[model samples]
Target: MRVPHIYQASSIALNTPVSLNDDAAGHIGRVLRMKVGEHVSIFNGEGGEYFSEIIEVTKKSVVVMPLRFDEHNVESELNIHLGQCVSRGDKMDFTIQKSVELGINEITPIFSQRCGVKLSGDRLEKKHQQWQKIAISAAEQSGRNYVPVVHPPVDLKQWLEQHTDEIKLTLHPRAEHSIKTITVPSAGVRFLVGPEGGFTDEEMAQTKQQEFVDIRLGPRVLRTETAALTVLSALQLQFGDLAN
Candidate 1:
């Protein structure tokens, strides 16, 4: 049987007993119904995982004893930072989840002119937390050692000004360049994807002015969510760790 993996925030050491937090405890005790002495893996989003076994289980808590540490990493060689305009409802959640599985190193949720979701104050914080959890779960399932970082949402212009990746591209239907035409960079790549309605002409001009190459996937027009996933998969197949 496949051993389960759980994400924890504390440092893991051999023979050390660690208590699972409320959420993790619930998952192990209630959801998975893991029993004492069962083997499991624990990671802290720090590029390594610990072999552990359940030591204590109760209604309120689950404790595990670490056995050994393993250097675990499934990250892509070509680091991809996705600047995605937040889509509405479950669309945004699905995008964030898949991006983590595809080995994206960083994700910045962008608020474009055409973005449908709007948040402020506590609502923004809640959304950020929710998306971050999705990223963590994705990492665990995909066997990735490190968890992808989901940045707080930012406006499109602000994100463009702050980002400094070696290679940057924005998806546009009428762009002159194709993904095949651009040369791969040595450092990393950042891809900008618009929301459902897509970027306006002015927004496209601004992105181009900031040195983001406009590229098209093909003749067909893809939805915002579709475009991001397609480009990520293509990049992974072409020049990322997925090709290994």
Candidate 2:
């Protein structure tokens, strides 16, 4: 049977007892119904994972003893920086979750000209926290040692101003080339996708000024969420560990 892998923020050492936080404890006890003495893996989202066994089960906490540490190397060699235009409702959440599983190194929610959701201040903070949690869950489920970060939303123009990547491309329905046509970068790659209504003319101009090459998946025009997921998967298959 596959043991559960949980993400914890604290550092852990071998044979040392560690307590799960309220949320993680509830997940192990109430949700998964993991009892005392059950084996589980705990990771700090840094590098390796700990081989742990549940020692004490309580209402508010679950204590575990880490037995050993194993180095992990499941991340893709291709470092993809996803500039995703925030979509409405759970679409954005779905996109971030799947992207993490597909090996995206960084995700930045871009507020483009046609984005439906507008967030600021406290609302933005809440959304950022929620998205980060989703990415963490995906990393655990996908056997990733490192969790990809979900950056706070920024304007498309602002993102372009400071952007630097080995290869930069923006999705365009009318573009003449697919990912296969572009030369692979030496280190990392960057991708940009638009919202439901697509990027406005002015925003496209800005992307062009930043040297974001226009690329197409095919003749079909994909939705904001679909476009991001599809492009990321393609990159993984071509240059990431998925090719093996």
Candidate 3:
């Protein structure tokens, strides 16, 4: 059987006994019902991972000793930073999960004019926490040693104004360029996805002012969630690990 991969927030070193965090402990002891002497892999999102053996298990705790360390890295060579318009319901959650699995390095929740969901104060903080957890979970399941960072929600203007050497891009139905036609992003790529109703004309103009290249996936218009994933896949195939 495959040894389960767990995300432990604390540092891990060889021969050191490390206590799994509450979340991981619960999952291993309760969810998976794993017992002492079982083997598991643990990563701290700092880079690399540890091959560990469960040394103790209790009703509320789980401890492991690091047997070896593997400096495995599955991140894409072409760095990707996604600026995704926050979609309603589980759409945002789904996008966050799949994007991490696809090797995206960072994600920022964007609020556009057409964005229908409204969140602020405590609700916004909680939502951000939830999204970060989803990213971590996705990393664990996808065998990624580094967990992607999910930034707090930001307005369209705030996100657009940030300076980056990364090639900035946004999608449009009538864009003249596709992924294959655009110049390779030497530094990295920072792409934006619109909301359900899509970006307003004013918003598109704002992106243009910021020098974001407009690119289209195909002739047919895609839903916000679909567009984000589709563009990511195309990018990976074009310049990232998928091409290897």
Candidate 4:
């Protein structure tokens, strides 16, 4: 059987017993029904993983002793930060999950003029936490030791104004440039995926002003969720780990 990979919020050290947090504990003890002496892999999002064996399991916690450490790195060489305009319902959740699996390093939920979601205050904070959890889960499932970050939601303008040396891109149907035509970036990549209704003309103007090059993916327009995944896969194939 494949050793279960669990993410713990606590620091881990070799030969020391580590108690998993409640969420992970529940997964190993209650959900997986794992017994003592069973092996599990644990990562704290600090890079690499600990090969541990369960020493204790209780209703409330699971304690494991680290036997060895692997400096495994599955992150893409092409660093990508995705600025995705919030889509409604489970669309947003699905995008966040699949984006992490596609090797996106950072994701920021963006509030554009056409974005229909209106979360704020505690509700917004809760959603942000949920999205982060999705990212972590994706990392574990995809065998990625380093978890990607799901940053707090920000306004489109706020995200656009942040200075970045990376290549900036935004989708535009009428644009002359395609992803194939843009010069390969030496550093990272920052791209925007607009909402289901697409970005307003004013928002498009702002992106251009911020030096976001408009690029066309293909002839047919894709849905908001499809667009995000397509961009990630295309970029990965062109410049990231999938290039191999």
Measured by lDDT, the strongest candidate is 3
Error of 1 at 202 (Å): 1.3
Better of 1 and 3 by TM-score: 3
Clashing pairs in 3: none
TM-scores for the candidates: 0.97, 0.97, 0.98, 0.98
Local distance difference test, per candidate? 0.89, 0.89, 0.94, 0.93
* Model 3: per-residue Cα lDDT over 181-224, one tens digit each: 88765788999999999999999999999999999898999998
Higher-ranked by lDDT: 2 or 3: 3
Task: Kindly give the stretch of ten consecutive residues in candidate 1 with the minimal lDDT sum.
Answer: 159-168
lDDT of 2 by residue, 111-172 (tens): 98789999999999999999999998999899888999898889888888864756889999
Residue pair clashes in candidate 1: none
Over 4 Å off, model 2: none
Q: For model 2, what is the alpha-carbon lDDT of residue 13?
A: 90
Per-residue lDDT of model 1, residues 38-135, tens digit only: 98899988778999999999999999999989987677788889999999889999999998888888999999888999998999999999999999
| Candidate 3, number of clashes | 0
RMSD of each: 1.1, 1.1, 0.8, 0.9
